[model samples]
Target chain A: MITITLFEMKKIIKSIFFFVMLAFLCVFLIGYYVFVHHQTVPVEKLIVETESMIHMQEQQIQELKRTINNSEDGGNSQLQLDLTVSEQLLSKNQILLKAYQEEDWQAVLQQEIESNEPEVERMKAGNEYYTSTFPTLFTLESRLEYNKWLLSHNITPVLPIDFYSWYTVYDLDFGDPIAEEYIKKQSEKYSSTGVYFLHHTLNLLFTIFGALIFLFLFGDILTKEGLGKNGPIHFLHTQPLSRLKIFIGKLLAVLFLSLFVIVFISGFCLLIGSLFDGFGYFYYPVLIYGEDFSFTFQKMSTVIFQSGVLFIFVLLFSYALLFLFSILTKRTLTAVGLTIVVLYIGIQWGKDTILSSFSPYIPFHYFSITDIVTNTFAASVKNFAFSMSTGCIVLSISTIALLFLSYFLFHLQNKLLH
Target chain B: MIIHIQNVKKRYKKEWVLKGINIKVEQPNIIALVGPNGSGKTTLLNCMTNLLSFHEGTVELVGKKHTDPSLFKEVSFLQDNRILYGNLTGYDHLKFICNVQHLSTARITDVAERVGMSSYLKKRVRNYSLGMKQHLLLAMAIINQPKLLLLDEPLNGLDPTSAITMRNILLELYNEGTTILLSSHNLDEIDRLTNTVYFMKDGAILKESLLDLNMRRYTVSVTDGKKAKKILEEKQIDFTSINENQISFDETTIDLQTFIDYMNQNDIQIYDIDKQKIGAERRYQELFEGAK
Candidate 1:
């Protein structure tokens, strides 16, 4: 079994496809490094966007005043209310722009809290907890607490206090494309450091691209061994080893090599980032989603570590699934294609309402490794079952199931293909 | 018993490729399975080695069931070169066989030398020629010094010298008490290797070993063939006159010594006698007559 596993790994490592995947990772890292300079959105740009908003609000307030002075309209009271709201917004923008210009992040955060606190209070008073902009009290409070945390920690704001969420858009958009782009680019992901670069790559990699890299790399493991009577796999089959050992050997090979590739990417990113910049804080706070719309923060290093653990299992689950399909299809591309289709459908359907109650049971829900760690997908879809522990359990079970099924089919097929 | 395949049956899709095949070998001897294509020769071999599951009956090698993978420690199958990983070197293949069979790593070098593939043993199988691949397959098969060696077309892609080497290696293994079951289309090579031949047509084996009926054919060339032919014809002997100076007949008709004694007493000078072991070839011709 060890020999078979080692031989499989040697075959994979000797393959040009493995090197190609490494090159792609290097290119992503180098490309990020080359373009990271432009990724950071300066506070000056935010200040300018705020000033423009303030100027537009002032013009609206002036127009309201002229209309009030020119005519004694019957609906002047409503117009006056509009005028008051517009004036309040105008003053809020002025204060924010000034704090940004002075680089007083503390004052700016305080100002934002002071301004939004009233709206949150009014919504509570009127029982209007949801809005298009502020969908829930959780969103309002999450952003408010995010700012308070930053203020208490004395960490300057790189992104808005709501955290780097995919669903929230309350950051400094200023109704301008430039401001929106600026807001998206303000994360520490653009920073040149070991922690920052790995975090950034981790966030991007847990998606389909990472799955595909390993899938394509090891996709042909079984098929290349010769499912046919004349295949090289018969060489092993004709040996004294059992079929179960062969399956275990290939399984171990995929798992070990997959872990190697994942770690290699992470280490390579860190090497490039630290070599160029420096080793940044592993304790940098990353937001973690909680039940009941509650939330907490974890260290960046912890997040990455946790993501690695879960992603390893996720890759195992994928390989197991692919191996099962390989036995059925007996062709590399077709097996990979079938696995991707199945995984894709599982991810999509798991997100949908078909069996929403069982989302946590679905292994594909944890496809986004980071999302699972942070409970982002769970909180987004309101299914608290999709946590990291649940992800590990579900994927472990699914992998074992697929492995058993695959081995059964492979055993049955040894004679059929003959 | 080294090989005991009893009433084994195998089907390919809807066709019965092996129908109630039975063979039992209790001693260490080379056995050849010669047949036409699609005559269940390879299928029976596969069934015996458990490479292909039989529909019915039992196959045991060296007292262990074929299904027991440990039987492979005492049994080796020299299949087509497709069983070789093209990306791996011949040395890798030999080393793997040794590892799987729990043999010493020292055997790889020994087997490579014995097969006369030592020079190209370290080269990738993809870079090897057809004969080189055959050598690697042979080396891998014999690396464990198995008690029973099953070879299917082992001489498929070999040069004359390599074929001779393979034959010598098999003979050596036979001398070492290895029981060999060989299946091939080359009757001449089979004849050279073993006298116990099984001829198959369709999905059944021809019942007898043909050893009882397999007689040495004698081609006697005398200085004067006319007198020899006249004497043989006068005695109502069955013979073929190759030319005026030569005549050929099987031992079944008359013992070679008796025929030679008659020629010497009749003042006929026997120039040369070519004795041919045509057991397998003749049986093959008779069994698969008109087969291309």
Candidate 2:
């Protein structure tokens, strides 16, 4: 086993470095574009711009009041006012300001004072009437408070939040010192504004590219032993050892080195993210949905357990495929190439055949590693009486079958290829 | 018996690669399985080592069934191609095989030194030449001091020195009670080393000759070889000739003595009377020619 592992380690050394560097560069660029520069620049400028606009509106309202008091037409003319359209517009803005200060957008108390034109009067009356009548369920303040609640509770998002649009247009500033600090801390958690599900899907697609890179480089390690024109078949077979041992040793080495490549990429991604954005991630207040949808330790534990189980299953499935390929081809490069082609095709086929429909019933649907990020397919989809039980049964049976196939191919190589 | 093959027959489509071949070998002897290119030698060896499944036969080794995993501990088959991991140094290769073979580090060192590969043990096999690779393979072949060693054309690409070294190593192992079944095309090497030879032709053993003693023979060059042949025939003596001068006959019978006496009487002065040793090459040719 040590001999096999050592060989496998040496084979994957280059791929490990290659993947790690790739992951680092990818994450670094994403962090620099979205978090470090994009997030801070426009947000700060928008805050200042919103404050200036509010002050300018207030000054325009004061100037209109002076005109109304000084002009003879304004003093006695209740029906025909001397106020310009801009002044009336500015007066309407003051009403909006008073409504905002009251932490609501209801009807103004003095609608007749702002305008006597039946059209303007009716518009102001309707606006104020709806505010006083309709119940305010989803306010901006309540939304921010919900976000704070989510972070403290570690609630994952089940729905999208377009905060960038609302924040830009409404100028919903959290000027309260404590609230401001809370908002900044929460904003730092995510560092980007987009739909969670879409964001995750895109992340998975990018990560697929990483997997493809690994796939391309995978076969270089395996075929080097078998594909040489005049290779040392005699040396290996004549060593008074079982062929199975040799096959197993080689398998172990390849798997070990392959894992190292995966870890190197993961570590590099972390390192680049840290370098580019000072090691931070954004948090959002979110509503989670599942079997146990709650902001509790038990829910978090469920996520970890479910995700871990899915991860292991996916890893085993991939390893089994690679093992079968390695034994069948007896050449590392061909095995890797075939594995990639088959897997790439398999994923597409599976998506079309199984995933687009009731794919959760198919055991292979859950055998996807990308599901860890996307969170679409799970062990079971329907909440039937024995759905979970059926899913486990199917998964276990398929996994065992795959393992058997791997061992069978390995045994066949020993018997026939010798 | 260290290795035994009983009526083994292997077929590929309509052709019988090995036809009911029977081989029984004991310890402390170098047995060479010599044959032509497709003469069932490799197939028979593969069957004995359980690498190939014989259609009609049973193979036994050291009282254990060849199909049994326990027998693997006793038999070490040196395959034709030296298959080693590309990245593993020769030293690492030895260590890996030694661990599996249950031999000590000292034993590995000893085998390395015997094969004259101690200097190149630390280098990767990718860097080793064909000769060096052969040495490494030879080292592995004798690693476990196996009771039965199956070598298929072990000296195909070896240099003279390495060949001699390998021959001596096989002899040494034989002395240590290791029975070796070595296959080769070069009949002379087998003739020098092996006690028993299995001469195969057309998928069957044509002859199994136990070479115990060197038969005495003489090659005579006659001035009138055709006349000499007629005289020898009248005298009822056996002789084989080439051209008009050269004649060959075994000197085992007293008929040759009588022929020499008659020759003396007739004053037939023999130009040459060189002693002939029946070599493996001649025996190999005779096996085929006699079959025809």
Candidate 3:
């Protein structure tokens, strides 16, 4: 039996159709990441130029203060003019603040042209000067300070000269405490670069495709026992083994293959991310504000283990569903299609009001409780114990329910003398 | 004894598929469960192996009751289509069956060889010709040297040569004390393979004919055509006519010399006398069609 299961696994791996789709998705993911990365470059440069302008304004302020001591109104008009120019620059670049944070730069550049602010034109005029001169003044070390000073002086520079109206008061400086927030947010930039969008779209497409493959391949996995060229019940029930063992063996085999596909997809995503986004882990958080917010291997392994337990429950439930449907229907497709439809409806119901109460009872709900697994509740009496106990209880009940349902269906199939 | 089924009744939707079937097959006997389509042959076979449930009945194979743990170990049911795994090759099917039967791993190769499928063992069962599929099934059935072999339509796709070879193999197995119960549409094949003939129709065994003529003792020697008539008249015996020189008797109890002496006493000159073995095909048709 074990050898048979291993052989089944090998067959799933050798499925050329599966590998072809995976390969296409892998390539598409990589290509999309590359495109997104390229788009991030221009935005990063714009941000860097804005930082340099703030520092330049600061140096000019210091020189003016020195001249003021020498003569009361010395270069004051010139200073005011420069201040006005800086204010104009800040207003011009205000759109970049919202764009940068939201990762919606394309929307801003596309939509900002109708604005009627003086700074939009000033920022447009200052674009070449800021781009060329800011580079000579600011180094890597002085860049942060320059951005801080300009932000304090209300100077925000929007990037890529676009024709958008700019009437609103532009507060370039996020705030004193917000500087840390901005830096933290800035490090994690969102880009709608062609590559990123392409990869995102491809991920959805491939995932849907992969799931469809699994649904079709395994949906009838058990029901095929009934619907093969031979009668399903005849072939399977005739074996010496009990129907329960056969069902379990087959269910485990499919789950094993599904897990393989899931891992394959995850690996493919990582490879794509590596090529395009400089290798960021999806589930693991990299350094954010010098703190490791990542759920590391040690932590993730627990999630994996818990997830494995949850998966067993799901597998059992899926088997039960298929088994019951198989018992009720003639063709394997009917069983499989009904299962997919039920799951779809179940998911939709869980999202809505009527069936949401039964969500805990739904096997699909337990599939993604990793969030619950990772969350460490506060030391309150109800929080920690409730979460932990509920998880374990629900897991136990779901497992038992699945097993019971499967056994009932097995008995039914056996009773069918046909 | 290999199998015993008593008063088994199975129904499919209001129709009784197997109506009170009672059969017992003891060792060293090849028994044919002859029946037509929808006749309870398969149902009874399944009941014996516990593949399907019967509402009322008792079935035992190798001393284990139906649904008993040991039932599967003792019986090998070769269904026409359901007996094989499609994805597996002929070799794989044999090996898997061997493993399931707890037979030696080498029995897979051995059985495949015996079935003359050694060359096609590696070919997938789905890709096999119908004849090849029959061979693979037979290989699996005999892989374990199972105490009781239950084959449903085992000869369905087999060619004449393969069928003869299979019959010979089965007889050899029977000689070694293996009990075989087979179902088939071919009455001729069944007649040759088994002594106990079960004629069935509409889910009931219509009649059973015991083939008692196992020896070659009944020889008809005709001296003169008139003398042959006199011997038949004097002895109160029945003989079937052939040509002018030969005649055959259906009974195996009569001696060849009795006919010769009876003819000689009648002053008839003896020439050539030959006895031919009776084929069971005619007897089988008589048993099935005559009763129906």
Candidate 4:
């Protein structure tokens, strides 16, 4: 089995297609970094710009108040309302800016929560001030509430709203709501400028072309031997190895190959990011959906570790599924096509279905493992209760089921041979 | 018994490609399977190697089931050239086989030299000609000196000299106690390699021995064909006239000496005599022609 796996690894690495796709991935990573840099605003620059905007808004509010007071028609009701909202927003921004300047995120979060509570209570009791502001206060109150929860749990409160405007801001036309939400949530959990860039870089890598790259790299793992008029599959079939061993050998080879590519590409991106920006704080906070479906922050290292585990499981499940398809179809393109189509339909459908009650049992729910690890899937999918432990179990079961079915199907593949 | 195939039945869709093929090889020798297209020669070989699933019965190699992985340690199937890996070097292929068979690297060099592929073994199989691929297939089949070797069209694309070399190698392996079951359309080469022939038609095996079918026709070109005909008629011998100057007769029916003596006595000068040997081709025609 080891020998077979070694041979398969050699074949994958020596394949011209693997190297070609790898080259394309490297070029894409560099291009993606450049594009991201162009799109996103630097955190320090954004803070300075926001301070200036706050000062301008304050002056405008004061000027509007004076003009409305001088008006003869009951001080122009709409202008008064605008001044009131602007003054409230200006006070909130000044407090946030002071907290940011002092780096006292806890104090900023406590103050925001304290300031929003009265409005939230008054809105619940039908107050005109909270009602007129409606959705804006509703969004602010939710952020403040979540931040207070983070602070109470001894977690640092990172304001997602502060950086939400810059997350994939220029790449908005991607039109994937889940990806957009993921980018927005990830951007909200800013630690340092460097970590912020790294976070988005990795997120873009996973959300955009990750699945397609996996398909290209591993789609043919099983079917390549059976391709063309003259195939080398017979040689492998005639060897002194069981069908299960052969399947496992190929699976391990693809897994290792994907790992190698992921590591190489990620390292390249990180190096490029560091050269241009810098490596951000290793202890940056990553906000994840907690057990109660509320937002909370975890250490970036822990989130990364969890993402890595989920990423591996996703690869295993996907490749094993593809392996099964390859055995059934004996065509690489067909297998790849079927896998991508099924996954696409599943993800699209899973988002709308009320499967949260049984989401842990549904294997497809775990396919988007990055979303699962980041708890973004919980937010999108109704009734979803995503936990890392449940996700691991679900993926493990699916992966094993896929592999066993693949072996069973592969054992009968001799029927297809002439 | 080196190989025991009993009542093996294989069906493709509604058609039975191999119906009740029961072949038992009790001794180590080269056995040739001859048939026309779609005659189940390849099917039977594939079944024996478990490359194709048979619907019924079983194939036992060296007293173990054919599907058993351990059976392959002593058994090797040299399939068509289409089975070789195109992207890999011939040496890579040989090395893989060698590693699977638990043979050392030295065995690869020895096999390469023996098969006359040492010069091109390092080249990728895609760049190789049909003949080179055949040589590699042969080398792979015999690299481990397997006890039971199944070859499907082992000489498919070989030149005359290469075919002769392959035939000699098979003969050498046969002498060394290797049991070889090879399928080929080259009757003459089969005739040289082995006398045991299994003629397949419509999924049935017709076992035959070339020694039993050793019939020949001797053609004699004479100066006086009329006189030779008269002499043959007087001796009550049967002969067919090729032309006015040449007469041919079955060697089994008439002795060469008796005809030569009679012609000499009749003062007929025999310019040339040729013996056309009856081989697998003739037997194949005799067996399958009626069915066709």
> Quick one: ranking by lDDT, best first?
1, 4, 3, 2
Classified by CAPRI criteria, candidate 2 counts as acceptable
The worst-scoring run of ten residues by lDDT in candidate 4 chain A lies at A163-172
lDDT of 1 by residue, A293-316 (tens): 468878788999898889888898
Most accurate candidate by lDDT: 1
lDDT accuracy of residue B179 in candidate 2: 86
Off by over 4 Å in 2: A1-146, A149-217, A220-255, A279-288, A291-309, A322-349, A352-358, A367-396, A413-418, B208-213, B219-273, B288-292
**Arranged by TM-score, best first:** 1, 4, 2, 3
For TM-score, candidate 3 versus 4, the one ahead is: 4
Least accurate 10 contiguous residues by lDDT in model 3 chain A: A285-294
Candidate 3 C-alpha error for residue A367, in Å = 5.5
For candidate 4, state the interface root-mean-square deviation in angstroms to 1 decimal. 1.9
Per-model i-RMS: 1.9, 4.9, 3.5, 1.9
Q: How far is candidate 2 from the true structure (C-alpha RMSD, Å)?
A: 10.1
Structural similarity to truth (TM-score) of each candidate? 0.79, 0.68, 0.67, 0.76
Where model 1 places Cα greater than 4 Å from the true spot, the runs are A41-189, A414-418, B212-214, B218-276, B290-292
Best by DockQ: 1
Candidate 2 per-residue C-alpha lDDT over A1-418 given as tens digits, one digit per residue, 9 for 90 to 100: 5654554465455344446656664665465445433433333343354456657755765666676767776655542343454566565655545544452312322332223234334544554322211111122333434444444554433222224221211223455667555544444323322323223323443233434554555545444555322344334443444656565665566456545554443444445445553433234332221232111122332433343444444444555566677667766666766766766776676667653444545554444433332232331232222233344555567656766787666555434543
Order by DockQ, highest first: 1, 4, 3, 2
On a 0 to 100 scale, what is the lDDT of residue A340 in model 2?
Answer: 68
What are the lDDT figures for the candidates, one per model?
Answer: 0.80, 0.57, 0.58, 0.75
Error of 3 at A252 (Å): 1.3
The regions of model 4 sitting more than 4 angstroms off are A47-198, A205-209, A227-230, A293-296, A379-384, A416-418, B207-277, B289-292
lDDT of 3 at A347: 51
